[model samples]
Target chain A: MKLDRRAFLGTATAATATLAAPAVMGSARPHVVVIGGGSGGATAARYIASGAEGAIDVTLIEPSRMYYTCYFSNLYMGGFWDFDNLGHDYGNVALLGVNIIHDWAIGVDRDAKTVTLASGPSLSYDKLVVAPGIDFVDDAVPGWDVSKQSLMPHAYKSGTQAQLLKHQIENMREGGTYCMVAPPNPYRCPPGPYERISMVAHVLSERNPTAKILIVDPKENFSKQGLFEEGWARHYPGMVERIGPDFGGDRVEVRPDDMEVIIDGQTQNVDVCNVIPAQKAGKIAELAGLTNDAGWAPVMPADMRSRMDEDVFVLGDASHQGAMPKSGFSANSQATVVANVIRGELTGSRIFPARYSNTCWSLIATNDGVKVGAAYEPGEDQIESVSSFISQTGEDAELRRQTYEESIGWYNGIVDDIFG
Target chain B: MPKLTFSSILLAGALLAPAGVFAQATPIGDAEAGAQVYQRECASCHQIGEGALHRIGPHLNRIFDRRAGSYEEFRYSEALSRQGRDGLRWDLARLHAYIENPRALVSGTRMAYRGLRDEKRRADLIAYIRAYSDQPQNIPEASPTALRAEVELSEETLAIEGDAEFGAFLSAECTTCHQRSGDHAGIPGIVGWPQEDFVVAMHAYKQELRPHAVMQSVAQRLDEEEIAALAAYFENLGN
Candidate 1:
């Protein structure tokens, strides 16, 4: 409810940034503070800073030393992709005259309307856009704790844990256990666990065909469920098994070690377990007091501004997107929405959001890909999809080729948006 | 000061200001330079020069004066095509604005390229399209614009009627690349295109169907049903 000095300073900085900008475009534009220079943040920064050159200002804030995309993280872990392929740099944001600040958020003072970075500096905004992406609720499970993350690394957000999962996949011998506990419904990248298994099974089958990959799930259905399960049955049968919560498979009381997963009334021994424990907004969201009891911030449709904070807008995995699972693409699209809204606010214009699109591609196998996508728009108070698409069913050789080509194309394309 | 001297000074100032603001209309690059760039960048999907064909997007032969979404075939995203289905012509000014930075000009479009931002580059590109266009020569002269406008004046005489001749004036940009051939590559020629499919596709793209980043970029600029008029016009053209 009240902002500290840093938060106050951030707000003051925004005002200064706003006022300092010439009302008229004499080549210098209004500056926009885009927190989380990921897909959404970077695109907004690039467009406003460059496209509207002499008309807008753009500053990007991201904490990652390097951007490791979740899009192809599964491939990277499966040994099919190199880490560098998924990594992106912020130089493009910088090239466009966008201020790229590599720092995390410590607090957001709604009253003063400022964001206090972990670096202790503050940034004010003509408008503030938060595409901070998703956060893991390390303690989402009743008995689980953050210190025990080593035992169950979600590896979902990419970067360090991504490498952790990759190393485990490499070292584990044949007949070892690969337990990946899926989250309840509405998590980022719904088809992720299924796709991860497919990718792992493909790699493991060739190296260690005897390895059993068990998926512990909390939901009966998933994104493109029919398509994913179909691929498993056709290619790697019995090697990849999913434990349905209703069918005597417990979600997870606790995983004391990477070697075991407890389900129903038994302890299943595991070799390398990847428990994608449930997620909410990142820690900064909680620190900024943006979450409701569910650990998500509610916002008006399309613009993604928190209903509680008008000057503040949230996008990506951080916002409660309802059925829209958090993925970089979704995050990026939401970023476009919020960025457009911020621009409109800065320039005094009306918002015209006819639609927004999200397409998530999962590398089910080394050379194969599966996808589930949807296009959304502002419904009354929230955004909803108007049309959805899925990767064609039954791996036609052509479909498979298209999938791989599309995946590569998408990666290059999105990378272009992020850093190009 | 003499009255003549003051008057002369005022006239000189007026002439210099616009010269100062507009700077110089770009001439270093003609539509020829624009043609080369378009061939290198946009020709893969968009038809830009003489006898243009769409690889992915619609032809841009005479796009200068066409309405935003008035094309009959080569389904445009509902977003951009919707803008002129109601007869909103793509005048030089609007075309330049859209070509500069599509997403800024229209949100919710699927066109992925950030748009060519250099004003001179854009003007040169448009000029190139104007310079290289090879539109239909046999279509007889008819007042498509007036018929459509007169229908609008009546409002009830013909439900959403447009002058085939006048609509053709607006349709020049569209027809150049449309059915210039029965079907070119993957794009269907407009000769026998079904208006329903054409309209629906525009709506879909406007609404985000066939969501290509580039299409999304352009579609977001158009509105609904402007899509319909373009569809109606195309549908009337002998299947």
Candidate 2:
């Protein structure tokens, strides 16, 4: 039950015929090129290379040498986690015989099975994995874009945005308002926006109790709504106010230049505005012609193969995953399945059944943590949840503390698993 | 139900004599009729007689007065595990509720059966299961053995040798949170345990005996050989 080198060499030669990539053709093993070195792509590359054991050549293309995870960015915002702990390098990933290319993957030629990098190199691949997390939809919010991120600061993506948002929160006026225009449904980390709100409330309650927190949310409900509400009432009473869609939250506009939020044509001055607009798959997936009408790449239920292209797979937040939230845990779980399937196809390894699970732990205030998780299996058309659980609202302090501690452990374990 | 045995009278006497000072006396339901209920509902997943091996579920020997999900050899659901860790014991009252509706007792339990709804049948089933368990009141004398059928397993149960190569492939799921360098800062290190211990622990998780949602989900998906393979791979890592 093994695929020999000749079969891989035959496909490799055919896939690279149009390109002048000698390294790929000369190599005896198959090549797997993964784009975006976040949780999905990094774990995929590491697993394939390690599982193949020299039988396959894996290359990972990511723009940043050090990846700062979005999972714990909220913790950093709340001053619970150090910023340095959120970053991980690909040194150990490179040590595992994976070709680490710190370059942006500009384009993918599905016809030629080649990935064109921004630094002027086109690498051919037998299989391509696209894990470019997400990009904000164009003009989803009026007067909001990545360029004005310095002013409004989406802080949605990893790295500098978080730092910028934190700086703004710290230096805000004593009684100034901190407004967050939360995104709609199908966004990465369903509990993320609420968690961010909790973090912001935490910082404000401690520093400026008089300062107000305004949540201009588009949706009527959010992840762990009950638990977050309970914690807010108990810990930061009279500090947080959420305006759902009923009060014109959906029809909102932000003027970054004037530093004002217009909710249903009524303008309100705010000190800091965190605009998390509607999101879509990263631009590269759309460029690769893998995205659908919904701004996400539809993937096969079994292995996350892009429905548009067989050779290409879309993982993580970019993927329109059913019954699985777009989170780092979900992405990492999917990446392992992708790696196993890719290895089985290219190197003739044993392919196990795809099993996916995700657990999101959000810290409400200090040691008050809540979690929701589910086990998923591939159904006929989409991934279906088999079992699930969510933390109760009235949980005791000890369990909450343990949940928070477990999250830290999980963070360490996932980063180690991804990078190494 | 069969006529009350001589020990039942003595047990009833013991419970009634202390009622003025302690809790009320409840009949230890009919064991003979309960044996039928066990055959119909519980036998498919659980085993209770002598030499009962860990099958789909853990052997139910010595279940009374035992901590919930505490059998090291069996895998219990994370829900059950947490309840056990939260000081839940398999007392008569708790057992009745669990048998009546498992999910009501533990939300994420993996026990697939819809539960025995009949109160009398449930009580009978509990009585049947209780026969194999330790009785604190009967500590001086050996507890009576059940008249149920025995389970004889081959000497070479789980005898399949783990292939380290396959284990290496499987270790991808584990190493995500557990460092390969075995630096257990927040998560416990999984490297370098005895293969047998590893196998047993994984089985406990697979059986859902161990707590932790992610671990239970991950372990439940793995087959017996894969567990062995992972055990062998993790045991030999960095050596």
Candidate 3:
């Protein structure tokens, strides 16, 4: 019989009492209720359930029957990975004995340690993990809000809107204008709008080379600015342009049907408008009263638990605990932290803390991809990047091939981390 | 699985008690189950020689007792590197803690790997990472040449001076699409180009014309003066 001393200690202690020493188990495993089966929530559910099998009851509550990734949908707009590659079934999670409930978490009674769902069902948990993804802040942009999403089509959240943007692009004849307005600081996928422009340009170059892609940006420059611009030019020449706030692109206005995007003092009519409206946490956060004045939840970094409530943990695109953009990679990374902390807290064990990593891949064109990646460690209160890298300026055959290849690998890896 | 006689196991530890045995006995993790975890979560990010492939993160060759976040090429988050440089190594106990919540341990890190809070999963992931313990450090793997193009272009910038003709040639095609003065999607107006900034930009483009299919051909035709003229042209447009 071989017995490791480390295992010996764990079993000896665990034998006497469940990890939750104070909270007695109901004859089964300790209940771990997870909200939002997106990147963070899904990853947490998979890891926790798989790791502790019978030791924990992992329940995941998600609104959507099928989850759609905001990542790579740009490529979908450009016709890259099919919906299958990006779409994930939660069966893998179900195989791990995790109760995957397709429902939305509407209310959280922190005092009672209860979660009320939209369907009038309630679940209690010894520990809770929340990874509800981003919420678009409609009020941030005047004259532009959720009601206007139908017209403007931010396409930031992905799904049907992503298809709608494609429809808009295909509908526009050559020589027509296509405009995209970017949000200010602290937005999801900072390099996203640029990638969308590049992809749209790629599509335009194929369908209508004479067509144009105009970017009305809030910032002077965007993430991986050099690489994106280079890719845009090499792949789709004369199809794209960028304007900034200082140059009259600030607080831009758009009329969807008429096809107009205005910045500063000037207004212009065009064929299509894709404005990525300001973003916050998803509606669930606001509904639960977890959002602050800025429309994002602030949390204690130790466990990514919201300041608004202790029993509840808010993560992914919703929380403002770390200094990182709201991307699939970052959200997936954040899920790891939240899952670990909840596991430790439930078991009364000391939690191991580590750094976070965010590597976002943006496709400038079909095979031309640029990546903005960074390695970050949690700061005193924020997550700060230590080293960052982006795609090179020129499109050498070797780099182009590698970037393209890596983009696929990145996609597959992220998908597995969540639904796989 | 053979049933282990309890007293004999205890006696074995007592009899073979080696000095400096500080190994903490933790819960049992089925290595077989851990192996699945290894393949799913770990093998993606870590490279354990043949079985492990290189992920965006690091190769976990001989990762145990390895300093925390001390990979040279991987360029760790300042926070992790600082701690590793501070003399922390990945012992089992520490490994468990880090796998759970990396941020709670080290701030300013970018591992993005959510800690495997499930002790069993942590054990499995650890087992997977530890499988490379005997292997040597896989150091300084050169980046594929294509990945370095951005680095090369980064060295050459668009150097501008006060010249409208060069700016006009530089931005000639620009005005055809971009409003030389308005803001909107996909169009960056070339109004008020800073002289020095314009000069640098043209030189960059003239070198390759701007790292794209269109810009490369466009900048190739322009002489250095044409680039400057374009810089000056845009500089004077708004001013």
Candidate 4:
């Protein structure tokens, strides 16, 4: 296999180090291994490598060559955004002296300070950052599994599933019902399911106005509930309906074979079913023994360091940090704090106090966007929201349009920040 | 008469001067001409007389010597707001430059007017607006006499040397929305800004003098030294 300059140097250094004492390894540059190159992992890897300026080595292992963000997938479904715009590559990220490996990281050997790859080689690291985003819990939704994903798509993870779901929506029978099975609390993107419902309504209102939409939500309340309810009432009136946990929304079971939803012991036929199951940390974190009984990796509020392993940091949706929602913005924020702490530990870089913030924007209809945001600070037990703001229900159209335009701007800014 | 010194002579002249004359400075242009200019140019979007409330733009009352975007209730464009936070006050020189060409002073200002090109007309308009402001002798803290030293930055705070390395680390948070490459679509670019402008703008956000939620949240957590470091780092970035 052809090797790059850094890889050749690493190999040569390894060979030379075999003849020297084990203590010589301490003198080498500290190596940071980052797993899962989404918002959290990618930002952390970029910051640590760029901030160190050749003082430390970083290797990022991600399975996919192109990362499709989940943040704007709903917009894509709504025909408001281009699907191609959701994809970003690591070409610029690799330029900052990081070893970018497009391979799966299968196991973590924490005691040995090494990570095993799906391809056969085991790479060693001084510190490891696990940012694998999320995995659906088994049997969280009865009669549903990943194998049945083609029949009833989750469309949650970033990939072809979003495309499949959009295709299904487009090809749906005229005047047919579209039912959604929303997940419980503590999921990625709190307003995501409602936003998806809005997008579905937007598409159907144009194609088949008679088509009805049903939501099976387990939570009592959702993010931007008032704003969304008002928009739905005004924009797509009588087209959508919702059932909360109090009304048997909590009792849900999906049958992909027959395309039916069983809610409150009542069977309803649907043309398209979107099932978003309860989630947990990605499987690799569990393999690393970093997850707790709740199937999430608990982290220190200050730095997002794994409570189990000081050298390992868990970020993004997989991390159970308090107050901050599991979002791309929050992940990016936490990654900056993680990068600063890690760089300061390895090299003598100045470590600033940890600060985190997050803002989530959602679109109800064309030029009708709403946002909720909070500033976070580390409290005694967890990260707490210091200040927060949400869009008002009765805001004028001009403000909503401005908010939508700002969301577009934010998308451009964040993608540039992440990929570059 | 009794061996009066220069100070005593000046004091006698001041005492003999007409009351309320020294309360206001000499108008830069004819007030009557300026009133005509205001009617012709600015009457549609702005109002300057007593009891003027916010219209399309903020009410121009007390606008002189006020921070650029400090009329917090109004929804100004991000570009104008950023400049205001960057220590752009409505003084004679700055207001002159702005009225001459709004875009030249602040790029992406949402002021739809092209600009007043005639130097005489712009001065007249500014003189008319300056009538609404409290005189310098009345409000010393916010007066046109304080030019570059308008904002509340102590000499010691400005003197603190910034560490570029630390700034680079902190800038990652900012760059999540504000591009480092100076490509600003909706959010304004912060790259290559003057260090003092950056510091002053950040302090404005920290103090809630500027009105942007994300910016305020980001700035509130940063200390004085961190702000300086970020200012230094962004100032050195190649656009």
Candidate 5:
């Protein structure tokens, strides 16, 4: 590794002197630039820095100083966890030798291997990890746009939008209806919309018993559908109703000004409307030309290297690998794989087989939690599921409680793993 | 840099044991093979290393001769606790039977594993578990006929001509929740699998041999050819 570093430095210095490059300073250590500090980017930055043992320099570019995880934001809405608990700072990640920069990455000059930040000097990297998460397709939902977001909050990104949605639910009129316009298929968190509904129902069942929750879903079947349905029937039976694609869930429009949701030919006035629009890879990925026709960067199943550019690796919600959900756990798992690959490439470290796993736990009621999980391996075209398990519908109260507790434990463990 | 301690090196050697063929009691089964079985089947919920804390299940250090549900730190299920009261220790026979089918042995054991139906694999797993015990027990050799039966069953499951391209198209439904790219929170990523292993596993799920309902349904949907294609597709995905 040391020998490679010296050789790389000698070549880099010669190139820099000849090219007069503005981005790189001919440093002896290899630089790794990570864009987006959410689950994927933060974990990748931290791991690359630590795994290389000071052999590589890592810089993380994120617009937000504090990252609020989308994983447990539903729990926050249900009052299970405080809002502050969802926010994580990069103090620990910085301690791991990552240079944390609070700025949005505007563009990627792939030819020059440089990343242009919104407000800073451009940084050059020997390797780059783009994990900018998701960005909504602005016009996917008719009559719904960012300006009208205040009236119909998505709360999917887990920040102020989440807080706004929580406020709307809490301040909703008694006996009023709260409707959610769920996103299309292939979005982040497969079971997120139903989980949000369950959490909202949990709050309404207690505080506003007369209040109703309506779900306008584009997909007919969802993740943990049986479990969610059973839990809803058991806990908040009459309070929630989901309208699938058969019931005009696909042809829905929200009138933010009138606070009305139009499904097919019928329209109903609602006190609160959460419109989660269709989504794609984060904007930075598109700007970098890493995204494919599907708006997600294609990656090799083994190491997550971008199909378009080998020097760049895409992780988490931005990459199209296979068989893994776009969840924080999945991103963190991918980060470990990418970190290992980056370390091996730069520092001559050993790269292990990419064995990935994820478990999504959704809390239906206070202590009623259901989980779906599996162990996976790399396949020919994408990641594939090797084995899987899920909580049974008729599980006892003790088991449900334990499952919820396990989710809490996992949340803490993953946040620590990623941020630290 | 700190110098490597003699004990630390020995510990490392033990952990790095590729075949886990420890020089303890007369080796009945391959400890290394058993270790792999343990990793794939039990490591998720159970721990066996030094200072391993009880997770979903109790740590299994020195588990031989220990009464069922005897770990003080872990809260055992009622069935396991009752068996512990009855003075049932995890001896070779008990471990083999229990691991082969926990619910069958205890009736209400909370361990989520469906059980290892392969007789040889069960023997190997028991042998691995024995290696972790203070008083290692000798595993009785399996009869040639029994081993042959298990091998035949495994071979039958792997007899399929897989097409990778067709498998990729069929994988769309699987990737809906399984995730083709990115982090897998609770879902496992299945890429780069050996074709034979993939086929056998899918057959297990399709035949209602695995405990997971979703996988069972998924496997039931895929015909033998489709399953073979999926196996071929995933098998070629290598690191």
Candidate 6:
């Protein structure tokens, strides 16, 4: 769990091995080429290689050398975590005998069972795990595109954009208005927007108490709505206001040059505008013809295997599985299941029935955390929730503190579970 | 019909020689059933096996006859620490009662679990805990007073209708660890399992016949129909 010098050495060795040979040398070993070394893909690659005990070859294809988790980036905004804490290298994952390729997976040739990378030889695979995470729908918010990202950062992808958003929030003039255009339902991290708002409020509450936060949300209700509202009331009274769909929250447009957000056709100049646009599966999944009209991949509940292709498994935010939210925890949990299933299929290891679980923890303020968790089993059509538990609205401060501590522990545990 | 081994008797004698706490009878409960209970309820907080680390709760290796709050590495609640200071050893009766309701025995205890209400299930869980003792063969017999019939469901009992769709939705909590597909590592997979088996297992956890705290808590929340629904859903999943 500790990232010490020895761990760094281990990663260096693995990276050296990967660069030396783009494709694994053993032709007899089943190759698992994973796209997107985020939570799902990295966990899958690690688990498959470790579970197989070198019986199979795993080549993880991710363009980035470092992964910034979207999970706790909100905490980073709130100054609870540093930028370095959100970033992780694949050294630990590579240590598990996985070929960590830092290149884009441009295309997947299903007929040939090969993955064409942006700058490397096409890698062949017996099984492929696509966990490309979410890509914003172009023009999801009218007049918004990648070019205007610097002007109005989405900060949804959790790396440079997040830093940019943080920088903008920090530099906002005193008493300035911070406006957020929330994404619609079925976006990554159902509660993420709200949590981010809370974090921003936390920062603003300390720095510029006179500042205002306005949320123009598309949905009538959001995840943990009551808890968040209660926390906002208690912590930052009169400072935060939300406009739901009834008040034209969905009908909003932005002019990046003017730094103005128009809600219900009323243009308001704001110091900072966070526009989280509509989202879909990453482009690679679509390019591979794995996605449906919904812009997400349909996966079987049994093992997260793609409905379109049996050998290809889709996971995380990109997968259109029933009930489970498109959160990091859900993706990691799914990755473990997929890894085990794929390992069982390839290595002839002991395969058991699939079970899944996820818990989402949000910090309403410092030392104030709430969580919702559930256990699930595969159903006839989709993965289902058997039972669930969530933090109550009127929980005491001591319990909230404990919940926050638990979240910290969980963050450490999950990162270890995935990267290690 | 049961043969008492010499080592078991010797263990029983050694255990009884000092405390004379346990009733001189054979521990009669299903270890397998106890394992299920332990996994669902106790595994998260307590560890009983080799190299078990002290988690939220203390490691419980050879806990039988050990003084309360005596695990060297664990920081006990004041109530439990005081009980240990008073030389209160954990006998079968006390351990059973404590697990059924930790706060009842030692008020203000930090253990979050509510008491296990089912007496028969408590005995089975104790038997399972007893099996992990260093000299498990030496543990005394379970008290007859706590004994009850093993829960069994007939075809008619399992005939409770369930909707797979609803069951799938309800199973999200279970799948948090069980996984819908793949190697469970330590956790077992529940997919493609028979409906009857799933129902029985869930019922066992629900009824406190199993020792796992989490599973017991999950099962206790479900009705027979809900359990049946989950069973139906998992039964038809995977190959």
Q: Model 5: per-residue lDDT, tens digit, A1-420?
A: 555545545555544443233233446678899999988899789878876778888888888989999999999999999999999999999888888777778989998787876754566788999999999997878889989999999899999999999999999999999999988878999989999999999999989999999999888889999999898998998888889999899999888999998899798999999999999999999999999887888999998999999999999998899899988878887888888889889898766567566778899998888888776779999999887778887876756775676578667667766764
Among these predictions, the greatest DockQ belongs to 2
Better of 2 and 5 by DockQ: 2
Worst 10 residues of 5 chain A by lDDT: A15-24
TM-scores of all models? 0.63, 0.77, 0.60, 0.79, 0.66, 0.68
lDDT scores of the candidates, listed in order: 0.61, 0.81, 0.64, 0.83, 0.77, 0.79
DockQ of each: 0.02, 0.30, 0.01, 0.30, 0.05, 0.05
The predictions' CA RMSDs to the true structure, in order, are 19.8, 10.4, 26.3, 9.5, 15.8, 15.0
Better of 1 and 4 by DockQ: 4
On a 0 to 100 scale, what is the lDDT of residue A274 in model 2?
A: 95
lDDT of 1 by residue, A1-420 (tens): 123433444445544353342221222234467777776667667655654554666667787768888877887777777998888887756777776667776777766555677756565555677667667675655445656666667788888888878778877877898887788755777778777888888878888888888888878777777777777877788887777868655546656553666787577777887877777876666676767887787777766777767777777777885556677777766665565566667665444443456677776654556666665777886787665666666645534544565566666656655676
Best-to-worst ranking by lDDT: 4, 2, 6, 5, 3, 1
Clashing pairs in 2: A413-B176, A413-B177, B75-B204, B75-B207, B75-B208, B75-B209, B76-B207, B76-B208, B76-B209, B77-B208
Position B34, candidate 4: lDDT: 81
Task: Give the per-residue lDDT digits (tens) of candidate 3, residues A113-180.
Answer: 55777766566666777778776666555557767777778898788888888898988977998888
Cα lDDT of model 4 by residue, A313-355, tens digit: 9999999989999999999999999999999999977888887
Global fold similarity of model 6 (TM-score):
0.68
Model 2: residue A138 alpha-carbon error in angstroms: 0.7
True contacts kept of each: 0.00, 0.48, 0.00, 0.55, 0.05, 0.05
Candidate 4 retains true contacts at a fraction of 0.55
CAPRI docking class of candidate 1: incorrect
- Give residue A372's error in model 6 in angstroms: 1.0
- Model 1 chain A — which ten-residue stretch has the worst lDDT? A19-28
Q: What are the per-residue Cα lDDT tens digits for candidate 2 across A312-341?
A: 889999998688999999999899999999
Q: For model 5, how does the per-residue alpha-carbon lDDT over B140-197 read when each residue is reduced to its tens digit?
A: 2222101211112245446767876566545534544454442344434567756765
lDDT of 1 at A236: 86
For model 1, the stretches where C-alpha displacement exceeds 4 angstroms are A1-31, A349-351, B1-239
Scored by lDDT, model 5 comes in at 0.77
